[model samples]
Target: MSLHPFSQRPRYSQWFTAKPQTVVVQPTTWCNLDCTYCYLPFRRLKHEMSAEVSDALAESVAAFADGAHPIDIVWHGGEPLALGPRKFTALLTPFEELRRVGRVHHYVQTNATLITEAWCELLTRHEFRVGVSIDGPAALNSQRVDLRGRPAFDRIVRGIDRLRVHDIPFSVIAVVGTDGIDHPEELLDFMAGLGCRSVGFNMEEAEGINTDRQQPTPEQAETFWRRTLEWSRCHAGELEVRELEYLGEYLRMIRAGQRVDWDRRRLDPIPTVSWNGDVVLLSPELADTTDVGYGNFLAGSVLDRPLTDILGGAHRLRYVQEFLAGLEGCRAGCEFFDFCRGAQAANRYFENGSLATTETNYCRVTRQALVTALSTVAAKEKEETV
Candidate 1:
C-alpha cells in the first residue's frame, strides 16, 4: 500500500473525519429491469454472495464499527430485493450479533421492482432505510424497462403503493435526463405525489457501460434549478431536493466568510464491496468500472484481508494515486475546487478519460451552474429586503 513520496499528501487528510461513514455492499448483481442509463457492467451476471463471505465482511465491518463511530451498511446490487426472501435474509443474518452492541445501520437502495409485503416486513423489523430509484411518471421512466423492452413503470408504482400502505418512509433517487431537464417543476411534482420526503437527482452521467450521454449546457442547468427552486418554495418544508440542499449549504459557508471544510461523506469511495468480498475504495461508481492500472477498481478483499489493511491498500492502486494527483491539480486550477474536490471519480474518469483532469461537461452543468443559479437568487432576495 506504499506510494511514492510525491503522492503521500491527500487533500482528504487535510479535512479529517471518519474516512468511510458508509459501506455499499452488492449482495448480488442480478437486476430484473434494464434501465437505459445503468452503469453496472455486470448487471445481468446473476452472481449471488456466499454466506461465508458475507459473514467475513460483517466481521470486518463490525470490527470497524467497534471504534464507536456509527457506520452504515448500504445494501445495493443489480437490485437487492432481487436476492429474494430466503437469500436476502441469509445475507443480512451475519449482522444479527453485530447489531446488538454496535452502531451499524442497514439500508437498501432498490429499483423497487420486487418490493413485496414480505420485503416490507423484513425491512421494518430490521429498521433498514430504503431509497427507491425511479424517474418521475411513466412517461419519464420509459427508459427504465424490463428485459423484454416493456415499460415496468406500472410495477414500480404498485411497489410504491405497497410501501405507502405499509407506512414505510422512503426517499427517491431519480436520474435526470433531457426530459427531466426540460420539465424540472413537473418532475418534482410527480415525485412529491409519491410521498417521498427527500429526492436525490443524478444527472445522466457518462460512466461505465453507458457512454452515449448528452449533457445539458450550464445555462440550461441554471435555468432548470431556478425553476425547480420556485416550485419547491410552494411546498417548502414538505419536499427536500438534494441538489438544492447541497448548493445552499455551499453558499452559506461561503457567505459567512468562514474557512470551508469539505464534506468527507461525498469526497471519496464510501467503500463499495462486491458480492465475493472485493472492496472498491473511494468511489461507489468505481465498483463496476475497470482501469488498465487498477484492474476492476479493487483495493483489497475483505474475505482475505482486514478492513484496516484494505484501506491501507488504497495507495497500491495506481488509479487512486492518479485520482489523488488529479485532485491536487483541481485544487491548483479550478475556482470551484473548494466546493467540489475533482468531482466523482467515475464521472471524471469516464468523461475526461483521466483522473488528473478537471471540469467535465458533467460538473459544468450540475455543480457550477447550480452555484451560479443559487447565488443569483440569493442576491436578488437580499436587494428586495433592502
Candidate 2:
C-alpha cells in the first residue's frame, strides 16, 4: 500500500488514493454560442456524454464518499443546458441511487442563453444550484455572440429574466476582459440590479484556445479593484464579490488557525469527465486541452474501467508529475502560494510554457492584485474611521 504523497506534506509521491471532492461532468462538447474568448478545444466536435458513463461516476463516487461531505457534481460543458430537458434528466438519473447512502449536491454552470421555464422547473425540482455565465450588461456581452457573429446579449438577458421570473436562486459569473477591466462600476451595478448576492470575476485568462488575449496590467487591475472594493463596502450586506469572499474565508482561516495553503492535493480535488468517458484531474479547464509534450492527459476511460482504477494510474502520467513539481516550486518560491496554492495549473502552462514554472500574469492580476487591493482599502478605511 502506497501512502498518498500529498497527505500532511508538500512532496510528490508515486501513487495516491485520495477521494476527490467534486465531479465536473461535461455532457456535451457542442455549444450554441461561440464567445470571442471561449477556450473549449472540442466545441466543434459536437459529442455528448452517454448514460452508462454517468453511472460509472455515480457508482464510483458512492463507493468512496459514503461518509464524507456531500458529494458535489458540477455540470459543466461547452454548455450544460445545451443538453436540454430529456438529455439533462437522463444524465442526472444515475445519481439518484447514491442519494440513499449519502447526499449528492448537483450544480450546473450555464451560459444563460438557453434558459427557459421548463429548465427552471427541472432545476427547481432537483434543487440543483445554478450558476449563470453573463458578463454584466448587454454592452459587455456583445463579445459573447453566436458562431454566426450575431450579438447574443438580448437573448442571454431574456434567459436570465426568465430564471428570475421562475424564482430560481442563481449566481452570476462574468469574465473581465481588457475592454471590461476599467468599467468595474458598470459590471457591479448591473449585477446588483439583478439582485445577485455573489458574483465570480474570471479574467480573460491566457489559456487553452484563448492564449492570445492580453493579460491586464497591474495598474489597470488595481484601479478597477480599489474602486470596486470601495463600492462593495458600501453594499457590504447586500452583495459579496468573489475576491472579497476569498478574503473573508482567508480571514476566517486566520482566526481559526487553519492553514491557508490550498495545496495541489486539493487543487481541483475533483474529476472532470469529458464528453467521451476520458477523465482529467486537477482542473476542469484542462479536460480537453492538451500539449504535445505531455501527450494525451486522458487519465482513463470510464467505459473501460471504474474511476478507482483510473485515478491511481495518474501517478504514471508525465503531466501530473510535472504539474506537481510546479506546485512544489510555487509553494517554496512564491510569496502568494499560501493564499492561492500556486494558482491554476492550466494558466501557468499557457502563459509560462511549463507547469514547473512559478508565477504568471494570471497569479499577478487575479490573486495578487485582489489581495493587495483589499488589504489597502482596509488599511485606509481603518485610519479614517478611527
Top TM-score prediction, candidate number: 1
TM-score per candidate, chains pooled = 0.92, 0.91
| Model 2 CA deviation exceeding 4 Å by range | 1-17, 100-102, 260-265, 382-386
lDDT of each residue in 3-74, candidate 1, tens digit only: 673555454354223356888999998899998888889988899999988888888877668637767889
Worst 10 residues of 2 by lDDT: 8-17
lDDT of 2 by residue, 8-115 (tens): 233334223266668888999989989989988888767999888888877777666664677788899888888889888988888876654556888889888899
lDDT for residue 38 in candidate 1, whole number 0-100: 86
Candidate 2's TM-score: 0.91
Residue 353 error for model 2, in Å? 1.8
CA error at residue 62 for candidate 1, angstroms: 1.4
Superposition error at 186 for model 1 (Å) = 0.6
